[model samples]
Target chain A: MNIPLLSLKSILSRPLSTLLSWLLMSFGVTIVVLILLVSAQLKNEISKNAQGIDLVVGAKGSPLQLILCNIFHVDFPTGNISLKEANNLSRNRYIESAIPMSLGDSYRGYRIVGTTKAYGDLYGAEIQSGQWFEEDMKAVVGANVANLLGLNLGSQFQSQHGMSEEGEEHEEQSIIVAGILAPSSTILDDLILVSIPSIWNVHEHEEEPGEHEGEIIDLPKLGIAVSQEQLEEEEITSILIKYRSPMAAVMLPRMVNEVGNFQAASPAYETARLFNIIGVGVDVVNIIGILIVVISAISVFIALLHSLKDRKYDIAIMRSMGATRRQIFVHVLMEGLLIAILGCISGLVLAHAAIGILAFYLEKLNLSWSFFVNDEVWVLTGGLIIGMLAAIIPAGLAYKTDISKTLSKA
Target chain B: MIQIAGLSHCFSDNVVISYPDWQVADGEHSLILGASGSGKTTLLHLMSGLLKPTNGSVIFDTQEINQLSPSRMDKFRGAHVGLIFQKPHLIAALTVKENIKLSTFLGKKPEHNRHIEEMLDSLGLIELAHRKVHQLSQGQAQRVAIARALINHPKFVFGDEPTASLDDESCMKVVELLKRQSDQHGATLVIATHDQRVKNHFSNKLEL
Candidate 1:
C-alpha cells in the first residue's frame, strides 16, 4: 500500500515492458563491467611481469616480438645471439646486471628457460620446496608449472625440442625437478628454470652423439663454472639488462642497436607501444559496451513513458484517494528507480559470473577476478541517473493530472 | 458540518456552473440530484476538495477547505473525506485488500489489519480480499471502492453516481451498503446521481 510497494506492483503489472528494459540494462552493464575487468587485468599482468627489466637485447628483430619472447615468454625467440657477444655487452659500464636466457625447449606447454638464479631474483621468486638447482641436469619449476604439470622434487622429465605438446622429446638427457618456486604473480610462475647448459646439453646430444662417451670430464655446478671458451662459442636467446644509471636510459638502446650485432628494446617503451596498439580495439569494444548502456537507458525511458499513458487513470485514482501531487510524482519515479537498481545489481552479478567463467578457462592468464571494483560505483550511479531522467517527464505529467477531469471522464 | 457558500466553477468563459449555498450537518445523509449537465458532479467535487472552485468557499467544520494550500487540502481530503466515483476506478495492480489499505496509507492514518479485515468482512469481500480488482464483478468492484473510502473512517463520504452502472437490485444493494457503512463509521454521506431510484433513500436532498 506504500508508494514503493505500489510502484513495484505497477511495474510488475506490465511484465513485458519491465522485462525488456531490465534485460537491456543488465546486458549493457554486463558488457561495460566485463571490459573494465579484462582491461584492468591485462594492464596489470603486462606491467607486473615486465617489472625491473630495463632493456631486452636480442638478435635483430621486431622489438615487440623480442620483448614478448624474452620478457613475457608468450612468443618465439627472435633467433639466438652469440653468448660471447651478449657477455661483452653485459660488461658495459652502464649495465648494472644482465640475465641471459636460453629458450627453445619445453615440458608439456610450459617453457623451460635456461638462466642463472638472477632471473628468479628479477621476479622475487623463491624456492617453495626442496632447493634451487645445483647441477646442470637439475631444474627449478615455477609454482604454476609445478601445479599444472604435477612436477615435484626428483620428478624426472625429458625436455621437448619446441614449445608445443607435439615437439620432439629429447629422451637422451632427462632433467629432474630440483625444487619448486613459490607463487609469484608474474610470468615467472609459468616458466621452468634450469642452467643454460641444460638446453645446450639436450641439443648437443642430438647433434654430436658419442663424441664425449666415457670421457672423464667434470660437470660444471649449475653451469656457472663453464670455461670462458665454451661459453663464448655457445648461443643464447636474449640478455635482460638493468641500467646502472639513468644515463643508460638515454644512451644504451641506441649504442647496442648501432654498435653491437643485437638490438636492445626497452621493456617499458615496447609494452606501452603494445598497449597503444591494442587500445584501439579495446576502445572500439568499450564504445560498443557504452552504447549498449545508453540504449538501455533509452529503452527504460520509452518503457516508462509508454506505460504512463495506460496508468493515467490510476494516477487520478490515487489523487482521489488523497495522494499528494508529490506522492504521485515520486511513486512514478520510484518505479523507474526500482528498475535501474535491479538492472544494475543483476548486471554486476552477471559480469562477475562471466569473469569467473573466463578465469576458469583461461587459467594461464592467472587473472585475479575480484568480486567488486571501484568503477562499478560510477556505473551504478549512472544507471540511477538514467532511470531518473527517463521517468522525470512521465512523473511530472502524473503530478499535474487533473483529478476531477480524469475521474469525471469515466 | 459541511457548508458551501457562493460555490461556482468555470470550465471556460461561457461554461461556468454556480451552486446554491447549502449545509449538511455532521452524520446527516444527503443527496445531490440532477441531470448529467446540471453540475451535480462539479458540486460533489468541490465539497470533497477534489477541484478548486473558481468562486466559492467550502467550509468543513470551522476551517475553510478551498482556502487551504494544495498539499494541505489533499491531506485534509485524505484524512477527513472519502470519494466514490461512478466507476470503481480501483488500481488494477492492487489486490482488493490493498486497494482498501491504500486509503489509510495516503491519508496518513495508522493501519489496523484487524480493521481492514473487519471492513472487508462487513462488505462480504473477505473471501476475495486477495483478488485483483479487475477480477471482481462490476458490483463487487464498487463495493471495494466503498471499502477503500470508509477505511480511514472519514467524517464525510462523497459518492458521484456510485451505482450508475449497476442494475436496480445491485444499485439498491450498493446504496444500502454505502449508507450502512457511513452510519457505522459515524460519517455524513452525500451522493450525486441522476437516477430517480436513489431519491427514495434520501429525504435530505439538494436539487439543482
Candidate 2:
C-alpha cells in the first residue's frame, strides 16, 4: 500500500537508469511490434484484394511473386501467361472473372502496369482525374505517382524498359495520362496503369534512329497471347486465376503445374512463408528482451542491495520507530514494481514513436504496406509484463533481508 | 505497556546479548544505557519488532510482539511506534512538511491537518518546512525528524542515539522537546544512547 508512493518516488529519483531500461526494453518490443504490424497489414491488403477472386492461375514460377507483381505492384513479374489461354480458361463454368497484365516498364520508378479497368475497380480504386484508359496509348497513374511526379491529365510521359528509372528505351512511344487514381491503401497506390495493348504497341514499334539501323530487332518476349491454333508461338510469364469454389483451391495448383511453365502459389502459403522468414527476427528480439529484463532486474537488485548497506542507519531508524522487517520488505518491493511500471509506460510511448517514423518512411518510399497495424495492445501488454518480471528478483531479495545483522553493522 | 522475557540473540557465532527479562509500564520514560557493542541497538531492534529474539517473548499489550507476523508487526509499528535517529534520516526527496506527512500517511493516521505548521512552530521549523531534507542543516533536519515522528501521535517513542551528532545546546533543546511532547501525550518514551548528557532530564531509566 505504502509501497506504491514510496516506490514511485524512488524510481523518479533515479531518472537515468529508468530511462535506459525503458529504451532497451522498448527497442526489443518495437521490432516485434513492427514485424507484427507490417505482416498483418500486408495480409489485410492481400486478403482484401483476394476477396471474391478465389484462385490465381499463373505461369509456373513463384505464385507469390506472380501475385505480388500482378495483383500488387510491389515486385517484377516472372513473366506473363498467354492471354488466349487465359481467355479460354475464363470461359470455364468455375471461372467468374479474368484480367490479364503486360508488365516490364517504369515511369519515374513507378511500375507501368498494362492492365484493364477491372484492375482499378477490383482493388476499389477511384480515378480522381480523367478516366480509365480506353485507347491503346493512354495511361492511368496512381495518386501517389501523380502527386510525387506532379503529373496531370493529358500529360505525355515515356516509359523505360526496366525496373530502374534510367532503364533504356525500346521506342519513344508517348503515353497520355488519361487518369489518376485515389489512394486505396493497397498495391494500387504505386503504379502507372495503361491498357494492356499499350505495352504490346510500345514493344511492337520499329526501333528509333540508332547506329544499328536496318537491324530487325526481336522483342524480349515476357508473355504470349495464347491462341489455340498456335499455342507455342510465343512465350508467357504467369497468369492469375479466380475459381468458383473450393474445388479450384484443391485442384487448380496441381493442374496448372502439370500444364504451365509457371508455378501456382497461394498467397496464403507465401504469407505463411513470409511469417516464417520474419519469425526468426522476432525470436532474436525476444531473446534481447528477456536479457534486458533480467539485466534490469539485476540492476534493481544491486541498487537496492547496495542501498541496504548505506541505509543501515535509515533501517535502524525505521526499525526503532517500529517498522517490521515485512514492512521494509514491502517498502523495497514496491520501489522495484514502481520502476518497472514506469519503464513499461515509457517503453510503450517509445515504441509508438518508432512506429510513426517507420510509417513515414514507408509512405515516402511509396511502399504498399504499413507498420501501424491493428494489434497495438499486444505490444503494450508485452512490454509491461517484461517490466514486471524485471522487478521480481530484486523484490525477492528485499524479503530475505535480516534486520539484526544490518543494524549491528551500523 | 511492554514486557520482555528471557530474550537472547547472537550474530552468526558471536553471542551479542543474552538478557533475562525487561519490562516498561505505560507512560514510562527510560534510557537504555550501554557501551559501544554492548547490544543497545540489538535491544532496541527487539523492542521495535524489527528483529525476532532467538529465544524469549516481547509482549506489548496482550499480544506477543515478537510472535506477530512480519506484516502485522509493521502495521503495529507504523501505527503505534515513533522512532528518532541521531542522523535524522529524513527522506531527502521530500520537503520537511512532506516528510512528516509521509509518516502520517504510512501510519494511516489522521491528516496532520495544517497542524504541520503548528508542530513546526513548536520546533521553530515553520519557516523551513517547505524546504527539502537535503537543503536543511544538521539541527534543522533533526527538528524535522522530530516533527515527523510526533505527527502520527504514536503510543510509544524510541530514540536511537537521537542527539549523538548535536551540540550541547541543540541536544538539550531536542531532549526538552521530546520530554514535553511525550509527557503531553502520556506516551511511553524509550531512548537508546551512549550520550550521558541526557541523564539529568528523565525521571525513569533502564541501564544495560
Best by DockQ: 1
Tens digits of per-residue lDDT for model 1, A80-121 = 998766766777889888888999999998899999898998
Predicted model with the maximum TM-score? 1
Scored by lDDT, model 1 comes in at 0.87
Q: Which ten residues in a row have the lowest lDDT in candidate 2 chain A?
A: A217-226
The TM-scores of all predictions, comma-separated, are: 0.96, 0.82
Considering the two chains of model 1, state its CAPRI-style docking category: high
Worst 10 residues of 1 chain B by lDDT: B10-19
TM-score of chain B of each: 0.97, 0.94
Tens digit of per-residue lDDT, candidate 2, span A207-253: 33211223332221212232233243322344445677777677676
Give the interface RMSD values of the models in order. 0.9, 3.2
- Error of model 1, residue A177, in angstroms: 0.3
User: Which TM-score does chain B of candidate 1 obtain?
Assistant: 0.97
Taking chain A of model 1 alone, its TM-score versus the true chain A equals 0.94
TM-score of chain A, all candidates: 0.94, 0.82
Q: Single out the weakest 10-residue window by summed lDDT for candidate 2 chain B.
A: B104-113
